[model samples]
Target: MTPMQLDLNLLAALDALLEEGSVAGAADRLHVTAPAMSRSLGRIRRSTGDQILVRTGRTMTPTPYAIAVRAQVHALLQQVQGVLAPSHELDLTTLERTFTLRWHDSLVALGGAALLAAVREQAPGVRLRFIAESSTDSPGLRRGEVDLEANANPPAAADVRAEKVAETAQVVVVRPGHRLAGEPAQPMTAEQYAAADHVAVSRRGNLSGTIDDALARLGLARRVVATAPSEATALEFVRDSDLVVTAPQATTRRASADLGLVVLPLPLDLPPASVYLSWHQRYDTDRAHAWLRELARTALDAPNRRA
Candidate 1:
């Protein structure tokens, strides 16, 4: 058959037949009758001059030619579907969607309210779901389970796209009456900072982090008395006790102020924590997804702008 006479339906049937490895199975998958699928297979064999699936004893096995072209056929089908899909202009007033965001808890505390308010004002039908980050790596983004992610760590996946939206300097947080809080005008030395007990914020429950590494380089170390699962929880530990926690300045500013804690400059040298917005490449051209990403970027940058 010439290229002009090629049938797209036959390509889909061939893909299913190769994947399922049985005529009956392929018919069931495509919601067609057995004889109808068999007739399509016969036409495919004549068109390609190859018996795509040959009967072996009781089961049907793919021929070498079928195995080689299986992936190509599936990919072509997807491309055709994408090409034929209708494009609809985004109508925020009547559009309804729920976007799932898996962000660091501190980020949620920093910008969740603003993002929600903006989305509600612009698109009353849109909803936001703020999920807590998992202690271990998850495939939620790759599998399309999570719509977006906001955190300091950028994903390493090749297909995932990450954009750095903001960065915040690290600062030390202490209770109002703590020794470090008393000397607001004085620049606390590394030795003085190391002398205080510390609380670490680690989702994985580890006591040591970048701060520990920086301290080690300076031949000093701080004692970590406890570990909190989130920065917000760590700030609570600092609010009522002498334990100090080093956190991103912008993200924790509001929480520290509400808790009546004092913020001090970190004595050790460390890079600022970078906040990245990550998503799968599949949503690159989705209009609604693009709208939400812009709002998210603005919300994340708001704290830094205020500072």
Candidate 2:
């Protein structure tokens, strides 16, 4: 085929038609009418001298040639998009965009105000929508529904990019008059800590965690009286009742003070929480997205700030 005679538009239409196997579906995918798609199919057929799609018993099927070239066409389209995509040079001051950030409730309760302030001071036109994460394996980032996700551990998907924003240790917390708090100077033994009614915080609503595993190694088990979906809720439960909960030392420090609760070192040893900022690989080169990721890192990394 000659380059001058080949219309890129026709190539796109052909690819869509071959993939959809229906002119109406292809039209919907390309945001055009069925009649327009039919006309484009005709042009593609005339230029390529191949009936890209052949009608068979009220359904369309790709011809042998069409099937052979489908992969090549898709790869070519991706190359074209990459070449035509905008560059990484951004003017944040005047950039007007709404970025959706999905994070755990504790992160929002801890760092939402600081992040919003930082974004506002730098880009007045930018808007940040903070949404609660429903699960650890959420596909929001890969689906383009969420621009960024902040969590202690990054998603396991290979297509997602993650960067460590901060780290924090876990601390045990309880109400002021709880048995564990009466003797502030004396550290509770593992058995004494395990004997108390505990409130577990998990996004999946499980009653066990790394703490329980550690306790199991020592042949001890704590009674989990309740399970809260978020750390903020768990803290509230701990504040109003005798149940104890473990949470990030830095973020929960502020909440603990606000709730008038006592913070103590965790009886069970666990690794420090590594906070991360994650996004899909598709956004790796996007200018606005790159800046937003940097802004989040800066906000969370600020002195005395918790991730």
Per-candidate TM-scores read: 0.75, 0.75
lDDT of each: 0.90, 0.83
Assess the local accuracy of residue 272 in candidate 2 as a C-alpha lDDT between 0 and 100: 83
* Colliding pairs, model 2: none
The residue ranges of model 2 lying beyond 4 angstroms of the native Cα positions read 1-80, 303-307
RMSD of each: 6.8, 5.7
**Top lDDT model:** 1
Worst 10 residues of 2 by lDDT: 298-307
Show how many residue pairs clash in every candidate, following the order shown.
0, 0
